[model samples]
Target: MSLLVTLAASTEELAPLLMPPLAFAGIAAAIFIALGFVVFSFRDVANRQGQGAGKSSDTHGSGH
Candidate 1:
């Protein structure tokens, strides 16, 4: 019982957060959104290479 009381008291005396808990979540959300934009920017890249870009006389059989 005494050990439990001591542990609770120690936990209550710990240092405060540098930022609010919500701020940490917001920072993580912003980073994910930025990365999402980066991935979105690469959309349809294969189609932009023009027709017949992958075809060649040396290749054979469905290309795969």
Candidate 2:
């Protein structure tokens, strides 16, 4: 019981020092993943075609 109490106290004392960096890393990862999704969505749009004859929109009228 004494060891558990001491461990809890030590963890409490270190939590403040440890939490901010861990939180920032999680937020940064979320932002990076979101940005990647946005970029991929845009790329998909840019390379997309309308109603199909099997050609990309970007090559519609630029003389092949």
Candidate 3:
């Protein structure tokens, strides 16, 4: 009887460890979606160099 009770208690305790797979999968899917967004938004555009202080292409000293 004691062994049966201990087995039943152990089984009951282990029930939770078997659950939460779907929760983990959902979190994984969200992380994957965020990573996809970052990978898709990355681009390399030429002729887009930064213009620092006192740099201009127009006439007059308008860049100062």
Q: Which candidate is the best by TM-score?
A: 1
Q: Estimate each model's TM-score.
A: 0.60, 0.41, 0.41
Question: What TM-score does model 2 achieve against the real structure?
Answer: 0.41
Reference-based lDDT, residue 54, model 3: 25
Model 3 lDDT-worst window of ten: 45-54
lDDT by residue (1-64, candidate 2, tens digit) is: 9999887778444344645787989989999999999887787554454435446555677564
| Highest-lDDT candidate | 1
Question: For candidate 3, lDDT tens digit of each residue in 1-64?
Answer: 9999887778444355544889889889999999998876664322244443224554455653
**In model 1, how large is the Cα lDDT of residue 28?**
99
lDDT of model 2 at position 57: 50
Clashes of 1: 0
**Model 3: colliding residue pairs:** none
Total colliding residue pairs, candidate 2: 0
Cα lDDT for residue 31, candidate 3: 100
- State the displacement of the C-alpha of residue 26, model 1, in Å, after optimal TM-score superposition: 0.5
**What's the distance in Å from true for residue 35, model 3?**
0.3
lDDT of 1: 0.80
How high is the CA lDDT of each candidate model? 0.80, 0.72, 0.66
